[model samples]
Target chain A: MTTTNRQVRLAARPAGEPRDTDWQHVEEPVGEPADGEFLVQVMYLSIDPAMRGWMNAGRSYIRPVEIGEVMRAGAVGRVTASRHPGFAVGDHVSGTFGVQEFCLSDGRGVTKVDPAAAPLPTYLGTLGMSGLTAYFGLIDIGRPEPGQTVVVSGAAGAVGSIVGQIAKILGCRVVGIAGGERKCRMVVEEFGFDAAIDYQSEDVRKALREHAPDGVDVYFDNVGGDILDAVLLRLARGARVVICGAVSQYNSTRPQGPANYMSLLVNRASMTGMVVFDYADRYAEGVARLAEWRAEGRLTSLEDVVPGGVAAFPETLMRLFRGANHGKLVLEVAGGKGTGTVIGEGGSR
Target chain B: MTTTNRQVRLAARPAGEPRDTDWQHVEEPVGEPADGEFLVQVMYLSIDPAMRGWMNAGRSYIRPVEIGEVMRAGAVGRVTASRHPGFAVGDHVSGTFGVQEFCLSDGRGVTKVDPAAAPLPTYLGTLGMSGLTAYFGLIDIGRPEPGQTVVVSGAAGAVGSIVGQIAKILGCRVVGIAGGERKCRMVVEEFGFDAAIDYQSEDVRKALREHAPDGVDVYFDNVGGDILDAVLLRLARGARVVICGAVSQYNSTRPQGPANYMSLLVNRASMTGMVVFDYADRYAEGVARLAEWRAEGRLTSLEDVVPGGVAAFPETLMRLFRGANHGKLVLEVAGGKGTGTVIGEGGSR
Candidate 1:
């Protein structure tokens, strides 16, 4: 057993894309649970595109991670030690445990999950923040009616994939925009999108016109920049654009804005930004609905569980920017395994 | 009265700023109206910033003014000849009469205006489309609560001046942003804005921070360029941005998009586009309320009333872009009355 916990911290604010030097690897004595506290051994760390936003030294939806602090992240783990009456050792839970192998928690925001029912990695992605983000942003903001066209950018990412599926379940004609042929194929065949546009190879504008001939009614924007501009021109009358995340602009020092925003006026449309945390009160309702769908086999939890633990946090995050991950990209603690490959890497979930 | 009508037609599609060559001045014989139509002698032509948008050959809220076609405009005039039962000679009316001396109308979209109640130019500006735009955009989209900080751009122009005044009447702290010292002064003193920021002289972001220290609750954006970007950064939680017009970008080949739009996500805010034409169903309701306010001394109408008739349109339109016009820029039919200036030329409409 390792006596020291290895953690990744933000060493400096990144200018563009974060390099290896931007992160600092430090080792400290494993923390113990204090009175009314519990210790969590992080098993799965969520690798989200929004992580890039937290590294920036600016105001955002949430506070930026300070220099020399453990990089803020959503993680699923097991309660190893506890002095709290509500929690016991060996209980599975999830919270913002950060980029660390061990986390000392007071159970303030921690949620107890059943590892036996759903995999631990699933809790870090589909059943967690990513799922809630897709749920609230699509249902509340996007508000896609049946027979309407719903377009989602970053189709293979954690939140976008779920957004497309949920829109599909609601009877919307779903079209996804993704980078590379593989992602485009996965977006359609795996996630059940009506169609997919390979943004890397195809003219996104032309592809959008072909896929959604009636125009996009609901646009769940995971990637901003040029994609947002392209989608703006194709909005149907009274379209609702959910500005959920801007992964493409996260690393950009000079983020591009949508020049075609006048389309909103032409179409009488609205562009609204949503933060899933605002729906904290409705999280249990969201989880219950998502879990219900999962049990009924109407929903599939997709996770690309990569091995390397907290030390591999920097490289794993790059996978999102590179569009290398197939589904929900998650990193877990290395247990004498250095495969660096996705576990259960095929078929639906 | 002249028997020949001098008309300005679109000679070419403008690339950036409209030039003299973009319009072709042609003289045509005045035509008589048929049984179902009425002929109008345009007395007051509305010279709006939106005219620049109509010249562009692109998809917008309204159809672009085609090359070689009569330039589009809103005008208030008296019916010279009426073959229709609804319209009689000498009846004061307002409609899309175009940039011409005489217009033939079917009375389909024409509305009767009373010159006794308000000035004829006011029917083309403050009590017309510009006023309607301000009313619906502020009350419907902005929905500013009492004590909320409401900000407006193009404050000395038609829509923005009215927007600021309405915000003040609604019990909001209103701040105006306009170009140059003169326009800023007019926005505060003449339009009754709480404070005014001269975009050309002051740092807009800094001025916003100082004036709206609590952050802006509602931002009525008449100019959408760098100023829109500046206001986006200073938005309070759940701020509503009303995208009424982009007077700043109307002449640009490549309109500058707001680079800091992500501030929308940071503030959980919304940017919504509004076209006054969309509220055609509620125009009477809006006009009635505005008229009531005017009668009670709670609201005032403002118009520059530049005299160049239709011939002075090209130059008078430039006044809006040059920040020359202090209020609603209106150009009546060339009455040969030299020394063209405002009608009232004093405090409040």
Candidate 2:
């Protein structure tokens, strides 16, 4: 193994859509793990749309990653070396390991995952931050009841795909809104969603009215802007709108607000914003439940793993904004193997 | 007394602000009470900002008034004749008495008010729907805590005035946002708000930073639009934003969405919409508490009773949008006397 580590660092905050020039690809010598610390070889890097928001210099749920710092990201990796009692060599762990081939951690926020229970990349997708976000934001905040109509935007993405499945598990009639026909098909046919609205092709408002005839009881919004306003107009009385992520607005110079927010008043609804980190204390509960659901064939975990080294990090992350990736967009490191690209088995899980 | 009932009916739906052509002034013979109904002589008409919303053609908390229908309003009146066993001829009562000299009710939604406990106009202001709206919205939705900063827009209006005083009673550091220096002074000095933001002359965002240095824990938003966006930027972690009214955007062809709503995600806050009618079952609870506060001199009730009786309904209601009314804008019928125009006494109550 090479003793050199490669890292993607934030070079400059982009005005709009981030470009390759906005990142710095650099190399550094791998450092040894100190006491109570572990060295991780990042195997599968979770490329999320929130990465765009983190690059901006402003207040967010978490502090903005400072300029020149290694680009922050969530990743699943194997412990290469460990001085911490909690981790051992070959132990699979997931954490905010950033965009790098090698990571040094104190094992503070890192949690061990069993590679046998689910695929390694699944840890970065349905069984990790994405899953937890959907679990809490939907069940806890959205408060979806049985027989209720639940609509989700960006429904084929990491968080939203899982959100739709969870809503189905809870006996809700799931309707997904995706950018393309392929994603919409995958969500409905493969992910057990009752209906799909191709926001790019179909009129989302009209489609929602047809599919959700009783009106949408809960809206799990990943894409904000016009999609959010459209969902706002279709909300049922006393509905709950879970503001999970605004992927549609993150790349824009100005994030569009939901002009139809008065629908909240007309329907006596609520819009609440949530961050997955807030449920850290209950992550184990979420992971266990998701694992059981996957075992029961009731949950679909889809991951779109791009086969490229860490050098392709910048371009790979841009696929989220371009609507090119169908599921969880992940960057598989060069040396990483057995990172499970299990497709069409047990319904795209 | 003249048996002619003069009414202001809706002639047409206005494109933006209601014009004189939109109202149809007509006269009719006063109808008598039926077996279970009571005939009321409307003494104090409550002209509210919500009147603008009611004129709009769409789904709201209540049905929109059709063209040629009597303009709906809440008013305090005396029971001139009662066929209902629950009410007496001399009793003072309040209900959806509409914009007219006389009203007939079956005693279903009407509630008896005490002119001796507080003045007749006081029932239309602090002891009526305005007070109940502020009470439930602020207490239940905003959930302000002691020592927390509670910021309210439309701070000198009917609902906003009560919201600020109630926040103070709950030990919250209250900040009111109003137009012009006169109303700002009234909110801070007369209504006992800790500070006031004069939105006309100052930058709301910059003013918020100075007045609510600790960040706004609860935002009681009555005037939604740019002001709501500004407050969204200043929200504290886990803040609660109460969507009371959007008087500022009532006349706009398209309501402006809050561009800074992502602050909700960053702060893990919630914005909820509430209608006072939702708490109709608990009106007694709110009324008892507000009445107690008024008796204790902790709550201030301000009313700007515009003369010219029911004929001034349209023009008096316009004062709310123009920011001309300092407190609760009301219309006193010509025959109505002893309604108590106690200006600046007991701190604008």
Clashing pairs in 1: B309-B332, B309-B333, B309-B334
Clashes of each: 3, 0
lDDT of 1 at A30: 82
Residue range B36-84, candidate 2, lDDT tens digits: 8878888888988888888988878899999999999999888777778
Which model scores highest in DockQ?
A: 2
Model 1: per-residue Cα lDDT over B130-157, one tens digit each: 9999999999999999999999999988
Instruction: Give the Å shift of residue B133 in candidate 1.
Output: 0.3
Candidate 1's TM-score on the B chain:
0.94
lDDT of 2 by residue, A69-107 (tens): 999999888787778888887778889998888899998
DockQ of 1: 0.67
Which stretches of model 1 miss by more than 4 angstroms?
Answer: A334-349, B334-349
TM-score of chain B in each prediction: 0.94, 0.95
